[model samples]
Target: MSPRVKGAVLGLSAAALFGLSAPVAKLLLPSSTPLVLASLLYLGGGLGLAGLEALRRLRGSGASGREARLGRKDVPLLLGVILCGGVLGPVLMLVGLQRLSGVTSSLLLNLEGPFTILLALLVFGEHLGRAGALAAGFVMAGTAVLGFQEGELHGDVLGVLSIAGACLAWAVDNNLTQRLSLKDPLALVRTKALGSGVCTLVLAWLTGQPFPAAQVLGGALVLGFASYGLSIVLDAYALRLLGAAREAAYFATAPFVGALVAVPLLGERLRPLDLLAGALMAAGVVLLLRERHGHMHTHAALEHEHLHVHDAHHPHAHPPGTDPTEPHSHPHRHEPVTHEHPHVSDLHHRHKH
Candidate 1:
C-alpha cells in the first residue's frame, strides 16, 4: 500500500483502540483512584510491549536493523513526551472523566486534534493548507459546542478545563514525538510507557492511593496494553509517514469512536448538541481525508538514519551486502535536489512552503 494510505489505516486504528479506553476507564474509575489506574495503564502497555519485544528477539524475528535507535540527544525530548503525554495527559483525562459523562468527555477530547495541529503550525514549523485550516476550525468549533453544559456550570467547567489541560499536554507530546518519529517506534513508546508508568505509580504510593482490587487491576493493565501500548506504536508509525499536523487530523476521529462506544456501554443519552458536534467533527475529518498538497520544493544535502526504501527522496548508494528489497536503516546522505510531488511535513518534507 501507499505510504499515505498505510498511515491513515494505522492512525484510524490507533484512534479506535484509544477511543475505547475512555468509557471503559470510566467504568473502572469507581474501583480505583485516577493515579493508580493511570499507573497501571502505562505499566500495562509498557510491560506488554516489552514482553513482545523480548519474545521477538528470542525468536530471532526482531527487526532492530530496520529501525534507528534513540541516541543521547533524544533524551530531553523523550522525557518531555513521557511527562506530558504519559503522565499529565492520562491523569487529567481521568479526573475530567470523574466529573463529566463518558460521551461528553469523549467528545471534548476532540480538542487534542486542534491543539496538536495548532502547535504543529505555530511552534513546530509545520504548515497546513486552506482546507486543513478550515477543518481544524470546525473541530475546535465542535469542541466549543460540547463545552456548553446548559445549566451545570460549576461541575462541567472543571471537567472541561481539566480535559483541555490534558489536550494541551498531549499536543506538546504529539509534536515532540513527531521529532523522534524516525526512531524505532516500539522501543520509543516502550521507554515512554515504562518510565511514565513507574513515576506515576511512585507518586500514587506517596499520595496514599490504595491498590485497586485484583480484577480491576488486571483489567486496567489489559486496557493499557491495547489502548496505550499498541495504540501509541501505531500512532508513531503514522507520525513518521503523515507528519504531526495530518496525523492529528486522522487521530481526531478518536473522540467520535469513544462517544459512540460511550452511549452504548455507559448507557448515556446524547443531547441534541452532542449530535451536532459530532456532525461538525465528522465533516472536518472528511475534509482532512480528502485534502491534497503538493508543490515545487528543494531538498538540501543532508545525512540521517531511518528505515526507508529507495524512493525519489532516497536514491543513495549502500554497502555491498545490504538488502535492497525491503526497508532498512543505515547512515545515508541526500544530495541537493529540487522537485515537486504530493507530500506532508514528514522528515524529508519539512521545507518551508
Candidate 2:
C-alpha cells in the first residue's frame, strides 16, 4: 500500500497502545512515586527496544537495509526530542493529573493535536484543508464539553496552564520527531527512551523518591515495553510516512481510546460524554482520510538515506543481487524532477508551501 495508508495504520496503532498506558499507569500509581514510575516505564521501553535490537542483530542484518542509521548531526535533534517529549512533557502532565480528575485530564490532553497542527502548519509548512480545520474544531468541542468540570481549568488556573504547557511541549516534540523520521525508527525510540528514562530516574533519586519493589519496577517496565517501546516505534514509522500534521490528527484519538480501555480496567462508567468524544474523533479522522491533495512540484537535487522502493520518487538503481521490488535503505541521490501525485508533506514531499 501507499505511504499515506501505511502512516494512518501505524498512527492508529500507536494511539491505541499509548491510550492503554494511562489506566494501567493509574493502577500502578499507588505502588511508586511519580518521577520514579515515569522513569521505570521509560526504562522498560528503552531496555525492551534494546533487546529487540539485539535480536535483530542476531538475525545478522547489518546497518544497511530498510532503515537509516543516526549520524553525528542527529545528536542535537535526538537530545531535544528526548528532553521535550520524554521528560518535560510527561512531568507536566503528571503534575496536571495531580490537580485534575482523570476525565478532565484526558479531555485536556486532546489539545496536543491542535498545538501540533498549529506548529506543523505555521512553522513546518504542513498542509491542512478547510475540512481539516472544522474537524479539529469538532473534536476540540467534544473534548471541551467533557472537560467542563463546572468551569475552565477545573477552577485552578495553574493546573490548566500546566496541562496546556505539556501539550505544547509534546507538540514541539512531535514536529521535531518528524524531522528525524528518515532514520531507523527502532533507534529513534530507543534513544528517546534511554535518554529521558535515565534522566528522569536521576531526578527522582535526587528528589529522594526511593525505588519501588522489584516486581513493581518490572511491571512498570513491561508497561513501558508495550505502551512506549512498540508504540513509539510505530509512531516514528508513521511520522516518516504521514508527516507531522496528519499523524498528529490521527494520534489525537488517543484520549478516546484511553477512555474505552478505562471502562473495563478502571471500572469507570462510560457516559454520553465519552461516546460524544469518540464520535467527534471519528468525524475528524474521516475528514482527514478523505483529504486529497496533489500538485505538480519540483524536487531539488538531494542526497539522503532512507528506506525506499524503486517508486516514482526513488528512481535510483540498486546494487547487484539486491531486490528492487522491496524497500531498502542506502545513501542515494535524487536529481531534480517535477511530478504530480496525491501526497502529504512527508520527508520526500517537503515541497515549497
Off by over 4 Å in 1: 60-65, 87-110, 146-148, 155-166, 320-325
TM-score (all chains, Cα) for each model: 0.88, 0.90
Q: Output the lDDT of residue 95, model 2.
A: 78
TM-score for candidate 2: 0.90
RMSD of candidates 1 onward, in order: 3.2, 2.8
Clashing pairs in 2: none
Candidate 2 lDDT tens digits, 1-353:
87778898999899999889878888876757767877888888999999999888878664433587888989999888988987788788867878876666766777888899899889987777787677666666656655554434352677777888899999999999999999999988999988889988887877788887877778889999988899989998899888888888777777677778888898997778677878877887777777777889987899988877776778887678775546677788988899787888887776775
> Superposing every Cα of model 2 onto the true structure, what RMSD results?
2.8
Which 10-residue window in model 1 sums to the lowest lDDT? 146-155
lDDT of 2: 0.81
User: After superposing candidate 2, which stretches have Cα over 4 Å from the reference?
Assistant: 60-65, 94-107, 145-159, 317-326
Provide the overall lDDT of each model, using Cα atoms, as 2-decimal numbers. Answer: 0.83, 0.81
Give the per-residue lDDT digits (tens) of candidate 1, residues 6-33.
Answer: 8888998998898788789989767677
